[model samples]
Target: MPGPSPHLPSGPRTLPGEGRTAVVTGASSGIGAATATRLAAEGFDVVLGARRLDRLTTLADSIGARALPLDVTDEASVAAFTGALDRVDVLVNNAGGAFDARPVAEADLDSWARTYEVNVLGTVRLTAALLPALRASGAGDVLFVGSTAGLVSYEGGASYTAAKHGVHTLAETLRLELVGEPVRVIEIAPGMVRTDEFSLNRLGSAEAADAVYRGVREPLVAEDVADCIAWALTRPHHVNVDLLVVRPRAQAAQHKVHRE
Candidate 1:
């Protein structure tokens, strides 16, 4: 969906990720896709996994990364993806998104279920499956692409906020539990990112999507968050960036945004 990526390092990326293997979920588009491409370009043997095999394959081909079909909500799918991988030096859990923007009183149970499945349970499944390989790596990195919604809630965001809060807690608890392990757990919470499909998918209308970023001078792009993810991983093994919150300059917080 993106134009030719100039961000990728030039030349043939022959094992550019070196021997380090990285797996990214929801990599068919947006943040996940960008993160997979960024990681691959950074010399990490990246595996692009998502439910959409066609798009995954396309991106994989473009970046010379492996493409695998993955649905984080399904245990079998996650198992199959992780089973196919022998080593996982880095795992980017980016498979989740907001479903609806309604108050709790009007929330749809089904939508909430879907949100939790992809955001919380899905992360649990994938991370659990890959923990062994990560531990073996002695410097494994696990990154979660969370959202500002995870940290603060707003009106018409009941289900999404709750789900992301679960993700934030999951990252915190996992880090403490893995204190002695070699694996590092990191969470990147981005705000007001205008991806091709994120707002459109959430609002289900071109006009609604446009309104989400209306009057904003500049919003965070997928590459901005990908840059953060790639940077955190490349750091010395000793440093574990517990949480990194990123927002567009116009967005001071979930409740505060500077609209022109």
Candidate 2:
């Protein structure tokens, strides 16, 4: 069975159209899509950002939110995403992924660069661009979707682990930098989420993807992560959830997994 969803405080949290807005990147699918939907249901005017315009549009339509085409790797695209926004109270930096699995000595530099572009630099660009809006809102809450790979090492995960470590550092630094301000920075490190495209996207092949988690029992789901994010975002203004780590019962560690 899946774990219980995280709990929220017992007060009126930030509400939608309360003159506040939320921007969710990588909103085309998985945790990003689920977070966007969850935020919308909580009455937040959500801005969905992703490379796939059609997917963003569909998500926005379903959630009654706005859509923006965002290629996190592109400076201009990140600029456009932040430029088009106003009074953003929440920012979920969920636009990132690993391209492939390979040893460091044999790794493709191009793939490594691509991963850094989306995972590390992309979060930096978007966060920097929206700092002003976040500062202006006085209730800025930033959430970065990190991974368990960041907290530990694994075979064929050099590039991804490096990028996620950078993300973790960035979040930590931001938390310190924004201490004087109302802005709060947080990181959610998830483990083995069974998103439809995650493994396929990483391996770039159906067979390879299928082999990764073929026998895993009760792997984490997108909604589970989304629920955690929602709970974090809804915390009282004075409370800040610095870091949250969530994994399925079958996943005890990065390499120590119980596969049925």
Candidate 3:
């Protein structure tokens, strides 16, 4: 899969955003934080939303963006979140994460449920809430920061993989349904990104997270993925990036990660 663009020609098209509003979920850390900053620099009025208010405030302050407390899994919270926004042109769904790496047979039901709620249900809620505004904007974009896990299954990644697969399909279905509509649905699936908390939260230890990237060549970072998001949104309104799969060279595939 391709990661970043080598060079992109500036098309003679209307930029999706030129003085527009963008809502970024999971802005508390990692890819979310990186994307929030990126969009802001791209001349967007960025709103940062996440459960962690303190972190959100910090990021918002640094980037001159608004921060909102949001829990995408809760319908009420999502309602309040969308209600607060007067206008939204772009919505970046970056709030999901992996809970555990257990096989299907030994899966922890709670972990799986949590994964689905946040990864799939949360995205559905937010996207539904913002659809009306997006359609009205005439150049709206819905971008999902998915994972390489969505494309291929692995031994101990059933739950995450399944949830991402749902996300992948959701993007596909939404795009097909929205044809000729003003809005566009795009999905960015990345592999083997080394963030501060991703591997640590999944594998449960500073040591374990360290080991995941130890002896590997440079892995993709949160900012790298953010770069992709910014680039896609800048394209002409008619150019919809259907699905982009990005993986670090070391991570050839989900099950074929190169450790050394």
Candidate 4:
């Protein structure tokens, strides 16, 4: 064999996310917090953002990251958050949540609007505000934390499903629009994740949220989803993970789950 071919390609000289700045929203709890922690350990200069300044500050100090107040649904908040950032190599849009679980026939229009405001409109606003900074980075990444609800609908989840569907499409459209750019657009969609506040916030009670996972032997936790996100972001610059859907072994589909 020829001793090391001169024409062969070499591996990356530096680790992915090394010496880069990553901004994570909705980072007060759940997947957002877990992702911020993981990314910080991976060598990125992480910035945690959420409306809860107290929680954000605690988490940031623990991980040696910076914490900033951000309310994605508020235009003023988005402007202020983006204005305070000096560099943004990675933008993790993780601020959205499900407010209610009701069927279309009994739909709460207010809840629907709130859902759309945070999941769809908020993501658009922040991404638009940071586009210039991302473009300037030369090797930027935009990652959306979406949901499996975006892929399939379930009973009593019209508002959340619809909003996540919008997120799915937004990621698709942006990727298409930025085809020739150096930016990498990625989306991580998780199924049946059992977090501290997600289910309780949507279902409206501790017991109600517990009932959602009563018999399930194993359901995904926030760290599980965060692991998937870290892996996707650490890939080679040219390798864009368009969409990564991760679910627990107990969950096979949106309508199907293995129970005790």
lDDT to native, each model: 0.90, 0.89, 0.91, 0.94
lDDT of 2: 0.89
Write the residue-wise lDDT of candidate 2 on 1-260 in tens digits.
96655674655776743566989999999999999999898888899999999999988998899998999889888877778876799999999999888999999999999999999998999999998888888888889999987788788999999999899999999998888898989899999998879889889988988787789988889999999999888887788888899999988889888988
Model 1 worst lDDT run, 10 consecutive residues:
8-17
- Runs off by more than 4 Å, candidate 1: 1-17
Off by more than 4 A, model 4: 1-15
Candidate 2 TM-score, C-alpha based: 0.92
Candidate 3, residues 147-233: lDDT per residue as tens digits?
A: 888888888888899999999999998999899899989899999898999988888999988998998899999999999999888
Please write out the lDDT profile of model 1 over residues 1-260, one tens digit for every residue.
86668876867756435779999999999999999989988888889899999999999999999999999988899888888998889999999988788788898999999989889999999999899999999889888888889999899988889999999999999999999889999999999999999878778898999999999989999999999999888888889999999999998888788999
- Ten contiguous residues minimizing lDDT sum, candidate 4: 8-17
The lDDT leader among the candidates is 4
Per-candidate TM vs. native?
Answer: 0.93, 0.92, 0.93, 0.94
Tell how far residue 18 is off in model 4, in angstroms. Answer: 1.9
Q: What is the lDDT of residue 37 in candidate 2?
A: 91
Error of 3 at 1 (Å): 53
Worst 10 residues of 3 by lDDT: 9-18
In terms of lDDT, which candidate is stronger, 2 or 3? Answer: 3
lDDT of 1: 0.90
Clashing pairs in 4: none
